[model samples]
Structures are given as structure tokens and as C-alpha cells.
Target: MRSRSTLLDGRCTISRCLPLSLYRARTTRPLENHHGQTPVRKRLNSDMPASTVSSRHFYQNETLLDFVARSSRPVSLRQLAFFGMKLTNDKIIQSANFVRQELPTRMAHRIHDMQSLPYSIVRNNHISYVYELYYHSFNTIRRFPVIKTVDDNDRFCDVLRELLAHHTAVIPHLVMGVIECSDLIDSKRMDNFMESMLRSRISRRVFTEQHIALTDAFLKDPNFKPTEQVGQVFFQCSAADVVRQCDTLARSLTQSSHEGIPIPELVFEGDVNTKFACVASHLRYMVGEILRNTFEASAERYQAMGNPPAPVLVTIIDAPQHVTFRFSDRAGGIPPEIIPYLWSFVKGPRSMIRHHNFKQVPVLEAIVEELETFVAVARGQRKRISSLTSLTTRSPTLRLGMGLPMCKIYAEFWGGKIAVKSIEGFGCDVFLHISKLGNESRFVQMNNI
Candidate 1:
């Protein structure tokens, strides 16, 4: 027996000067075919079973469990059917739900603690510890060995679903990270958080790709076919349709905001064959966001100067590996100093629009309903297993300050990027790229910026 030691992290019965063996791993011991009389036991010689085989390998804190139990925090997977929820994707909700069901109570409690961590602790180095611990948990879950029984195989598949859900969780955590950093006194650690966000984005993109490949490999067995896409699949997406939606959304929003101002005309420049191989929803959101920014800025600027807004130019360049969209607006260039803050998530006193409800969404209800229809239709390609009723979608609204940042995130998630160039005294040129081929696994990935 080893003498116990103590730290702020809690109790461990190993001394610092002890041999490495004192921290050694455990061997797996399983009972088999015990007919209530005498059980047959087997000692499996595998190194991973100690950490990976057990579902409770990650929890080191008990208070977290208490928090979840008290708050009833693990939301049911089925409840996502209602609209107004954070994510619209059904497959992701299913994955999250499966994890909620399968999560060991102790670990779930620990996760609740982490999830409930005050922004103050999460913004600093403290959050890294949580991520490091859970990274191991995620690693184990993803690498869980397949068992022979059908029930066992299904459990393995559930871990894959949870892993996907975990991928979706990355965005919220990073958002928390940035918000906390932005709240820092006098921007002391703001740069560090910014850098961390970029690194996290790249790392998440790579990890998502790898995990998808691993999951797809695991589910290749005939008995374990998962209907949802295990990876990204490509198809022809209509550029014209995306543009049309953007135009309509922009015009409608402009008219509403500017008291019937004429919306800037959009001139397309691209191949007659506007069919591009890309993800449809990503293109739609990005294009809509770009157009909205331009239309709003141009309309506001023209209204101030008593002149008709100039037509916004839309240029689409179809490259082999990617598609680029260039949107130029006549909003007189963005202020030089403000250009730097464009990418940051900082929301000053007047930064965000104050909207009490969904009714204030910028786009028309008819258009919002139509877009929802498109999403419903697109979701069919992925065999949706189950989902809660979606919260009714908010009418599409152009949110202040969020449009560019969110557009950037959506674009980058698919191995794409966005850049804005301002003429300082003229207009701003926003260039957005959509990757023709992205690792399907990284579909929900987002950038730190």
C-alpha cells in the first residue's frame, strides 16, 4: 500500500517519489456466462480497457454530478424538434441525445460542472484543464473496441454519435472562451484568446475529419450500418438559387429597415453553368449574409447623402478546388480603425441590436418559411434517425454585428475563408470562398476568429 498524498485536485494515494509502477495501469477482468451459481471469469490482456473500456474513466469531480441532478441539465435529444434551438441539424441532435442517454451519471455530472463553469474561469488557463481531461475522454470514446454481440456493437455506434455531438459542442465552448477574453480588463489577455481561437479552429477542423474517417471505418460492418452520413458527400449545388435567395433576403430587409428604399441591384459574373459542387446550406447562409451587409450599408449611406444606392456587384469565380464570391457595396469604406475590430467578437455598448423577439427578424415571414422548407428538403439526404420537434424557426433576421462573424465561421467550417477590403472612402469588397471539396467530417467546424 502506498502512502496517500493531497493536492487541490483532490485525493490520490501515490507519493511523488514513488516508482512509475505505483502509477501503473490495471488489467481487465470480466465475468462471463455466470449462471447465478458459479461465474466464469476471464482476464483480458489489453492496455486500453482500464481507460477506454469503462464509461466512468473521465470523471474526477463529484460536485458536477450534483449540479446536473439539481438542474436536470442533460436535455433530452428528442426535445430539439422545436424550432429556435441553437442548431438546426437533426443528426447532431440525435448524437447529443445518445450521449446524454449513455453518459455515466458521474461523468455527466462532471460535464455539467464544466459546462456551468463561470466565464471567468473558462477564459483563463483553467479551462484548458477541462479540455485536456475531456480530450482524453473523447479519445477513449472514439477508440472504443467493437464487441461481437449486436447489443455491444450498437453501444459502440452510440459512442460515434456522441463524438459527433461533441464536435458540435466545440463552437459553444470557443464562443465562451472568446466572450470571456473580450470581457478582460483593458484587453490584457485578449490577444492570447484570439490566438487560441484560431488554433482551436484549425485543430478542430483536423480532428473532425479524422474522427469521421474513424467512425465510418468502424460502422462498415453489415450489422452496424448507420444511415446518417458518416462523412461528407458532394453534389451539384445551384449558385443561381443561392444568389436569388440572397437578393430577395437583402431587398426585403433593406425595404423594411430603410422605409421602402430601393434595394441595390446585384450583377452576377460567372460561368453560364452556375451549378457548383458544394454544400448548399453553407453557401446559402454565407451569400445571404454577404448580401445583407452590403445592402444595408449601401442603403444607409445613400439615405444619409440623399442619393440612390449604387448597384452592388456580385462576382463568382469558379475555381477547380473552390468557389469565390466577391460582393462590392457602395457604403463608403469602413473606418481604418474599425477594420481591425471587424473580426473580433467584442460587442461594445452599441454593438448588438436589441430585439425582444423573433418578430423583428430582418427578412419577410414568407421568405423565412421558404428557407425553412429548403432546409427540410435538404435534410433528407442524410438518413435522419430521430429528432425532437424543432423550435419554430425565427423569421430570418439580419442580426447586427453577428452577420460577418457568423458568416466567417460558416464559411471557414467547410475549409473556406472570407476577407473584406475597404477602399476607405468608397465601398467595401467582401470576398468569401466555398471549398468544392471539404472533409465531410468537419462540416460543423468553426474558426476561432
Candidate 2:
């Protein structure tokens, strides 16, 4: 039995105040705010039973449960392009409706997952902010009327545009929350939560951006012809070309960061003209991150050893069902200490260092490109550029240790994979396998929560 003063004091932590089981019990009272007032609760949907509501988590609502009960519709590259080719008013409305219904489902699952986290983690200010953001977005989207007319769709798009902008800060805030709660949760649990959150986020963005692109295309020209690209999906994305472009950008960025350091040359090999059907921006980010790592490592190694930097070998292999990009670097391979946690988002010895540095730029404006830039391109102001190029231009040395994990997520999103083979004292090889079939569905791991 804790005293009122003890419970309301800011010095008391959730875990310190109550046992985990009791904290999670349905009968637990809602936590009081600094003003010692119970938060106002929304009216539960008439269909929902009182037993289903938990006072411990205020955001658990009927809309969230309804959406969470439904499964998400997955789209492939071919399916996405096929729908966008001959867009009409009806098709636009159909697309708008899909987005309207799908977004809330995805957001609901995320919020549910957040609610399922430990009470101590949920109490984190950053995590609480994210939870509120999702809840707000989820409610706002679910309340929107079904799209029937073009005017309705226009209004829906406006809402999406605003939500998308608001979500630009989600990644950074989530990262900070995890960092702050690192001691409260195990590495595996944190990784699983972050992975599920990010993958779902990617899926949501894909659906939203694709529909927006389709609407913009139809508005620009009623008789618009679909070429290689239909929104984010590219029917014949050039792998070798993306590599060369990323190489150039990575070299320039590395040189800028490590001034006067000898940067390694990228030696292209194998199929240099390989083309495939995939999302070009996702591929660009993976390749650019790999190239940047190799270049920076090679430069540092050579400079320290008083020797010239060695060239990096990039081999592109195009198979019948898949495309593979292999990046071989001679720079001293990944340090053995951090290799085990290479693909972890919140683990490893450098996590604290990364946390300290990330605090300097608390809010990451964008993961790939700013929303303004993406919207500008959609509005036909400028041609679309590589995501990595845009990101590096904004922050050349933006290394928060999320590159590899994010790359892995992007690869797995489309049923592809990323792997690394490292020799502690010699060199390393990074393999990026992409599904060329364009029929494989998005890879969504089940949330343990």
C-alpha cells in the first residue's frame, strides 16, 4: 500500500511503484497526471463491452480493436503498377478507400503493440508521445467518411498529406524512446518491437505514397501512359546504374567528412546492366549505406596505416528469380566486438555512444527525403532522385547506427535479404539479395506482443 504522496511524486518510477502483474491487471487505475487529475476518457463504442476496456491503457478503443481484428492487404510490385496504369475516377476512389481503411488497421496494431510493452517503457515520455500521435492519427483516419466522389478523395488526400508530415518525426522519437528504455527491456525484445514497428511503417508508407502518386498522375493527364514507374514501384529498375550513382554520392560524402583522405575506387564487375522490378529508393538506400561504410572504413584504415586505400569491388548478379549485389571491401573487416549486434537497432556496445550523438539531432527530419521534397516531385516541380542522395546531402555524417538494420528491414519488406560475411583482420563481403519476380508479398513478421 503506497501513500498518495508516494504515488504522485515524480521521483517514483512505474516499476518501482507496482508489480508488473498488478500494473497490467485490468482493474488497475489510470495513472494520474502531474496535476493529480484523471485524464478524460472517450466514450466507448456502444457495441463494446465494459470488460473489454482497460483503465491502465486509456487509448484502447472500439475502432482500434476492430481494425486490429482485420488483416492487412498486401500488394506486390506488379499488382501496384497494374492498378495505377489506367486510373479513372472510380479507381481513384477505390484507391482512396483502400488507404482509408488500411491505414487505421496498421496504426491500430502499432498502438496495440505499444500498449503491450512494459509499464515502465510505456511511461517513457518519447514513447508516450509516439503513442498519442498514433492514437490521434488512427482516430482521425478512421473517422473519415468513405471516399465516393473525387471531392471526398481530395479531402482524404489532404488529410493523408498532413498525417505523413506529422509522422516524419516518428522514427527519431521511437529511437530515442528505445534508447531511454534500453535498461528496462532486453535487447531481443527491443529489436523485435522496433523491427515490427518499422516494417509496418514501410508498408503503410508504400500504400499511401502509391495511391497519392496515382491520384497526381490522373490529375496531371487523363490519358497518362504508365511507363516503367508507377509511383514508388519501378518495373525495370537498373541495379548497376543505381550502384554507380550511389558510389559517386558515397565517395563525395566520405571525402567531405574525411577531408584529404584517399577514398577507394569502386570496381564494377559481373552484370553491369542488370535491370529488375522493385522499389528504386529502397535499393538505393541499402547500396548507398554499404558503399558509404566501405569507403569510410577503407579511407580510415589506409590513413592510419600510412598506405593507399584499396578499391572496393561491386559485383551484380542477375538471376532468373532474384538479383544480387555483392560489395567486397578490403578495409579491416567489422570489429569483432560489434559484429554480433550488427543488425540490431538498439543493442551493441556503441548504442550509448549513438544515443548521445543522436540527442544532438533529436528529431530526424526524414529517413530518406523530406516530405516537402517528395511532395514537390509528386507536384512535378523536379525529377525524383535517389533516397540516399537526398539523405546524404542533408547530413553527410548522419550515423546513428541504424543504417544496417534499416537496410535489412527494407530488403526483407519485399521478401529479399541482406547478409554480411566478415573476416576480423582481413576484409568483408556484403550481399544484398532482391526478389526480381515482383510477385512475392511483403514480409511482415508477426508481432509477439
Candidate 3:
């Protein structure tokens, strides 16, 4: 295989005539542990082993940095490398600060003064750029040999840290399109903004799924060696089981905080067909976040009324290409006034910013000294990354407010989406669509040709 120095010499356009051998090397599915239970399924438990891939990396290794760097647009490698590392680390940190500046602050004005672009041209160009990134990130990583020494492994991680960092940093670039909308409530403006944001998310999901699978493939490759053995056996995963785990977490969380508050009952409906190839951690995080909101809202309502909490119902549906989870809560549908801000990355009135209680958050580092996880787990061994709502991964209270939006990202990033509908004065129904991992990934139809 050609080295990156040789391969990335030219503009790596989506139309470039890349070799077939490279594609084959990068895209092959590694051997999977098909412990045949026919749609194998397992319930999530504390003993559930940490998800080797998804928990550690939100964006996959082969993604956009390399493509954008090699795009016709000029960029200095030194600077590009810095941008790359920043993006990945920012995401792992899920820095509330970056999200504030990049999305919300940018949107505040755009929500009032945004304009439209040449619709087809802008969207398509964005898609074209996305394809270019996906192609380069995946193919480039496939060419590396396994690390055989401690120094090589460290070097590999260091180099990978920078490369994946750049890929990650470029993700919020999708915010650029969304910020083009000024009138968040105007039908046309909303449509365009929603279209841009959703498609950008979909594009992200497509590449992310590629990253998840491809990274797993590489880690599982016999030629690969690392400081530790990340298991190669891919466990069959289940949505119903994950819901149960999240529900359990919700109960524990509510009990701790809302002391006298009734434990909001969480019921999970099982799937007739219960198995899929999936990243268990992502599903767990999304489920945990959604339920956390439900439980918190329910407890808060009761705390206000001096009444008991109502139950939240969870239903799971399994299909060939996807798994759907429905979380229904009776906490009085989100105040109609708050609906508009539902998806935007906004700073809410709550800040549970407790430092050092969890794993030591890296002191915001410079590029030269910077390093790497879905891991806010140093929040230590048992830690879960902060959800869409919580900034510190250690906080189980879910108050910092990135929750639903981040859940939507996690859900959709895998070709799944989370949608919510509320009945004024009554309740809310949230449907989480998880595109089960399998063959419908990457634009094999376009890119492979």
C-alpha cells in the first residue's frame, strides 16, 4: 500500500481515481463473534464491559481532516495538524465552551439575521466535501502497519491523536450551514436550517458509522498490536437491554437527588427481533440522557406539587435496518415556550461545573503538548461520558443542558434519529431511531465506483 505522503500528494477529491486495492484493504469487515442466538442480545449491566470503540472515540479515525487539508483550498500542514487535534480533543472533552462559541453564540445573531444560499449548490458542495473526507480518512489509515514496540505505539497514538483531532474539529463546520438561518420560526427559514442541520448530521452519521466499523476492523486486525488488548469479539447488542440499564441509572440518580421524590417508574417494552450489530455505549448514553430528563422533570413536577411522580414508558421496535426506542413521559410536555430552543446549543441557567471530582480533565492543552476518550470515564473506570445535557461526565443530574441535542447527534450519527412530540399540559413522546450497523453504510454505490 502506498504511504500517506505518496497518497495525499494530490487533491484527494471524491472523483479521484483511487486504487481498488486500497478500498478492499480498508473496508473489509473484520471477523465477528457471531455467537449464534439468532439476533444475539444482551442486557446492559454494571458488569457490562466498556465498549472498546464508541466509548473512547465519538468521531471515527477516517473522517474529514485529511480531505479538507488536501482540498483545493490552501492550508498549512502545521496549522492543519493543529486544527485536527483540537477538534478531536474538543469533542472528547465535549467542551461546553467550544459548543458555546461555535454553535450558540454564532446562532444567536443568525437566528435573527440569517440568509439563504443557492440551495442545491450549497448542500451538494457540502455533501461533496463530506464524501471527500470519508474517502481519504478511511483509506489513509488502512496503510499503516501494526505497532511492534512501546515507542512505535506511543508515536502511533501521538500521530493518530493529531490526525483524528483535526477530523473531529472539522465536524462543527456543519454549524456553518445551520447558522445561515436568521428566522428560526419562519417556515421557509426553519425548513432550510433544519434541512442543512439534519443533512449535515446525516452526513456525519454516515461517515461516523464508517469510522466506527473501520476502526474496529483495524483494531481487530491480527497485524495490529497495542499497549492493551481491545477485544476483537464484537458482541451482539440490544436496544431493550440498554433501555433497562438507563432506566436503572435514572432510578439511582433520582433517588440520590430528589430524596423524597417518588422514583419515576420506567418500563421497557421488549423487541420481537432483538439483536443488532451496534456500539452499546452510544445507545446507553442516549437512553440514559433521555430517561434522565424524564425522571428529572417528573421528580421536579412532583417536588413542586407535593405529589408523587408518574411513570415513563419505553418501547422498543426492531427492524432489518433499524431499532427504535420510544420514551414516553408524563412530566407535562416541555413548556411550549422552550420548544424553539430544543435543538440549538444554548447556555441554560444551570452550571454544575464541578472540577476534579471526576477524572482529572486535561488542563486545556496546547497542540504541541496535547493528547486523547468517549472517555469523560476517568469520571474513573466506572465513569460515563457526559451526555447531551451534562458537561461533566461525572454529574448524573443532567442540568447543564446539552442533553437532547447531543442525544440526537449520537442517535443520528449512526443513521438513527431522535424525535419528540409533546402534548401541551400533558406529556411527551420521544422516538429514538437507531440505524442498526450493517451493510447500508458508506456510499458504496458512489464512492466505490
Candidate 4:
């Protein structure tokens, strides 16, 4: 009998053991032993405990089409809150079951989408890595037993957290993969694939986090209030405050990188006190990216001219149903050559080359930590640190070329849009439109692929 370590090593080294063509071919076809009997191909994770490994089986009994057909409909912010209100033990169990059923379906759809990509593109190492991660996550979520008690819910939450953390490298890897395979796939097809994957990722996170939050709240308090925010979404999120917070963080990042250079002032105008119901973190990220770009550009222009930086004008328009923020900068406009590929994730020639050459791709957690740390310091939650020095070491300018594209994703997640208009030799204007109704369903794609 083989030792457990030997089995794990074999599983881990299987791809390397076979020729590339044989490995690729075997992924879609089964192998036959000397007796002409097909061997069972179980998807095992060496990282998981032996107990977990023993209980799980490869997804041989299910089909990708079946999982996609079983996927549940997306819920809106209002619906999420409504479900959380009057939370009970039964509700907690229901939430757990919902997540168990939903996550795997979403992951299956993404895996199918990747499988549909050009053969050369899908075969790239980075892309294959992402596919394996999704495949494993799907199997992990789908194999859980039915949730019956609070203890079961707790264990499920742990699984959700683990999977979420494990996926932090997904975006960076996907970016690298797409860049390397740019020649094999068309730009529009790549964008569609990426956008669908990202949107589905957001939807999964929302559902997973919401259930986890509900379980935690129920456990912590003897009387859990339905009105309390049990998830990432905030009901009375202040748009003005979010803008100010992002503005400060972005300015700090810009000021830290450009020492001895004058920093631009941000002048806020119109509807300064508008409050709405939405995800504050998403809003902060979008605003932070826009401000970071504007501030950095403005500072550089002024530093080159040996003059004070021009103030960036931010005008907020609060309507009955939506809120729009317009950013006007005077540093310099985007070059004509770069405008066409501004929102592209796979087409930046220089950035793509840099990404391709990277030994280790940046994870989403590190980026979030940098932004959160600055925001915490600005809010007096943590001791002050050297913003410039910290940012310089942590996140470099345009390191992955993901900010604008990701910002657009977060905005559109809740029915928002980001638009950029640049004038040659002049500054640029960006308009960010966010839905304030909180009733728009999440932008999740189903059978459309």
C-alpha cells in the first residue's frame, strides 16, 4: 500500500509526469489500465486534511451543464436584507444550504467558459492554474453535507473563508494568463470572458459573505437584530464620506510616491452630504482608483513645470434615483494611442510584458491591506505611518494595470458606470454614475455564455 504522502506527491506531480499532449488529452478523456478497465480519477487536495480527502470524490457523477442549470437566480441588496431580517436558526440553515447549492453552479459555469476559450489560451500555465483553483473550489463546496445545526453552519463558514482567501491570487493569475495568451484569443472575446468571470466572482462573494455574516450574528447575540448589517453591504452608506475617505487615501499614496513634488488639492463641490444604501467598500475602491490616477498625473505635470499642482475639481450630483460624481483634472490628458485600450485588461503592451516577466503576481489581499491601512490611519484607528514610504514598498504605480478595469467592474456590479474623456495636452474628465436605488439585481451572468 502507498503512504499518504506518496499519494499526495503523485497527485501533485501527475501533470509533470506525462507529456504535455498526453496530459492535455487525458484531461478530457479517461485512461485504461492493462485490463482495459477505466480507472477512477478522484480530484484530491493534498492541502486538505486526510479526513476531508477521504470523504470527497471527483465530480464524475455531475456534468457542467447540469450545474449551470441548477444555479439560483441573483438577489438584490433589498432582497438580501429582507432575507436577513428576522434571522433564525432555520434561516441560518437555509442560508448554508443555499450557498452550498449556488457556489458550485457559478464555479461550474466559469470553468465551462474557460473550457470554451481557444485551445492555446486555455493551455497556458497561468490560465490552467486558475481553472484548477476554480475546479477545486467547486468540488470543495459541492461535497459538504447538509447543514442541520449551528455547528454545521460554523464549519461551512470556515470553508467559505478558506476558499475566499485561497482565491486572492485569481485576478493576478488571470491577468497574467490573458496577457500571455493575447495572441491566441481576440480582444472582445477575452474581455467578455474576463468580465463574466469577475462578475460571477463578485456575486459568489456576496452570497457567501452574507450567509457567514448571518451565522456570526446569530451566534454572537442572544437576540440578533434583522436591521443590523450582517454582510458587506451597508444600508445607510454615506456617499460623501466615502468620497472623502478615498480622496484622502489616494492623495496620501500620490504624495508618498512623489517626494519634493507639490501635491494637487481636491476641491469638492455639489451634493456634499448625499447618503445612500450600497457597498461602501466598492465605492471606496472605485473612487480611490480614479483619484489616485488624477492626483498622480496632476502632481507629475506640476512638478515638471516647477509650479504648484492644479486642484482637481470633483462635482457630486445627487439625484432621486442615482448619484453621479464628475472628476475634472488639469494635469494632462491621456495620449491618443492609449485611449482605445484604456478599459482593456489584456492589451497594455508594456504592462503586459511586465506582468509576464513577474516571478510572483500580486494578490488582492495585499492591495486591500494597503488601501485599508491608509484609510484606518486617516480615521485615527491606527497609529500614523509614513504613507509614501509604505506605498512605495507595497504597491508601485500601474504595477498590474488592473485599477481602471477593476474599478469599472466594481461600479457596474451594482448597476454603475465609469466614463473617461481625455483632451490632448489638457486634463481629463471622468464621470462615475452609481445607482442609488439599491434594488438593481447583481450583475451576474447565467447561461448567456
Best by TM-score: 2
Model 2 scores worst on lDDT over the 10 consecutive residues at 39-48
Provide C-alpha RMSD values for all models, in order: 13.6, 7.8, 17.8, 8.9
Question: Could you give candidate 2's per-residue lDDT for residues 1-449 as a string of tens digits?
Answer: 66535533433444345433444535545444343423223221112222222233444355567888988776666667688878889999999998898888888889888767765576677777777667667867877877899988987776787666566557777888798887777879889999898888887877787888788888889788888888777888899888887787677677767889888888889998988877777787888888888987888797779678778899999887779999998898999999988998787888887777666553453343432243344345674543222321234565688888989988887778999999976789999998765434333332211
Q: Which candidate would rank higher by TM-score, 2 or 4?
A: 2
Q: Give a tens-digit lDDT track for model 4, residues 240-352.
A: 78778877788777766676677777788999888777756667778888888888888778867766767889899988667899999887898788788888887865665
Task: Count clashing residue pairs per candidate.
Answer: 15, 0, 13, 1
TM-score per prediction, in order, is 0.51, 0.82, 0.48, 0.80
TM-score sort, best first: 2, 4, 1, 3
lDDT of 2 at 14: 41
Best by lDDT: 2
Q: Candidate 3 — worst ten consecutive residues by lDDT sum?
A: 363-372
lDDT of each: 0.46, 0.72, 0.43, 0.67
TM-score of 2: 0.82
